[model samples]
Target: MSVTYLEAIREAQAYLLEHDSRVYIYGQDVGAFGGAFKATKHLANRFPGRVIDAPISEDAMIGSAVGAAIEGMRPIIEIQFADFSTVGLNQVVNQAATLFWRTETPCPITLRLPSGGTSGGGPFHSQCLESIYAHFPGLVVCTPATVEDAYSMLIESVTLDDPVIFCEHKYLYYHLKAESLPKDALPLGKARIARAGRDCTVVTYSAMLHECLEAAEEMSAEGIELEVVDLRTVKPLDTDTIIASVARTGRLLCAAEGWPWGGVNAEVISRVVAEGFNLLDAPPQRINAKDTPIPYHPKLWSVHRPAAASIMAAVRNVLRS
Candidate 1:
């Protein structure tokens, strides 16, 4: 059955709840009102005691999740908007992320963040803040692009012993669909090659994966065989996959929905420069959000994001360079 991004998330929650007794979910409006985006709609009714409504405090919610995980309970905490997670930075970096490396204790909290721009949510609600969490050690970060991936990897995140920041692109909630999940669902700590080609490799994740795929199709018409790599997991990056793919294509472009400066693309490019520099036919290029707050105006919003046209242009430029 074809599914939306919202449904994919609900399915994942159901799967986790049924598979493990220790797993539970809670966040703002998650109980009686469903979620702000209705991703967790009907979960409270279906699971009863398992789905909880949280008070209006991101820091408190995260702190409670950290404590729950430490006591052998698997908990998933959702920050209503990715921007709200700023209120919980102390719990994420200083607490949850450091527990393992500091005291040899396990933290299995899953921090689910709905991020990205496109809904005219303005600067506050539409920020893509995965780069902030990626900067910290001992935290695994993931952003899924497809509905199947959205379902599978979420289940995978629940089984991991480490804390994870799972960033779901809000713009993609209903923008794409897929028939069904793979029988052998994708595991954490791995990347998927979305489209295979011998020309240039377009490395991206989350909402930008759709842009890169569209660009790849457009590039095909112009005789440019583009390979698209969905770096499913940003933290604990699968650099080996990136290096090998770049080695085959001899050119690389890292695209993301976040701002260009210190974005995930920066890390991807740095990895290429560090390990795959010898395989590059040209310097790595980046097609990312313009270095500014996400504008509220529709026209300006269009210009602020990295679209297929921009990615295609970058591919052509890199090929000629």
Candidate 2:
């Protein structure tokens, strides 16, 4: 039987709950409601007290999770929406992120943010804040693109010594699926070459990875091969892998679902230009969501985010350059 990205996440949490007594889930509507997207469906009953619900306050949830982490517990704080995480930004960036540096204690908390845009989700419900959290020090930011990574990375995030920002794309929850859950997975910080090519390199993560792959496939028929790299974790970015791909292709294009300014796309292009300047035959390019609030209209939302057509156009521009 095939497994979906959402099911993989739920199973991963189940695995964590079963193996670790210290691991507990804390979030709004997470207990009986099974999270905003049902990523935690039936987990509360299955795990009992470990899957307790929290109040509506994001700050309180994060603060309490940090406290639990300090007291020898691993807490997974599921913010209902990625956009709502801003309410608890202080606790996440200040306390959980700086705990190990300030004190000798390890803050092992996994903050799950249901990220990315779904049709008509609007600005409040749809946002990708991986880059914002990645900007802070002492935090691991993971953006799992596939069902396998979704299952495996969540388990890894909880076991880490530092805090983690787990960005699980809401768009991929049901849209992406796999034949089976992975038995083993690549380490968290490593990047995966989703497709191999020589004409150009497309580095992307989360939901945008699928778009790049689709664009690559379309371009292949036209004799333009595009190599696609999935940067699983944006913070601990695999620069070596990205550089290697650029080395082979000599052209780079970064695509992301986030906004254009200072996003994951910009970071990838900046790194390639800085370290692999000589390896490139052309200037690296990037495509991101339009610099505006996510629109409520389905048609407007579709064009707001980077899609296969946009990625293909960007690839062509890089090739022409």
**TM-score of each model, paired residue for residue:** 0.97, 0.99
lDDT of 1 by residue, 1-321 (tens): 688887898889888988898899989999878899887888888888988999999999999999999899999998899999999999999999999999898999998899989657888888988889999998999998888888888888888999999999988898678786556766887999999999999999999999889989987987889999999989888999999999999999999988888868999999899988999999999988887888898888887898888888898889999
Q: Which pairs of residues collide in model 2?
A: none
Q: Which structure among the candidates has the greatest lDDT?
A: 2
Local accuracy of candidate 2 as per-residue lDDT tens digits, 23-47 = 9999999999998889889999999
Local accuracy by lDDT, each model: 0.89, 0.94
Candidate 1: give the clashing pairs. none
lDDT minimum window of 10 residues, candidate 2: 263-272
How many clashing residue pairs appear in each of the predictions shown?
0, 0
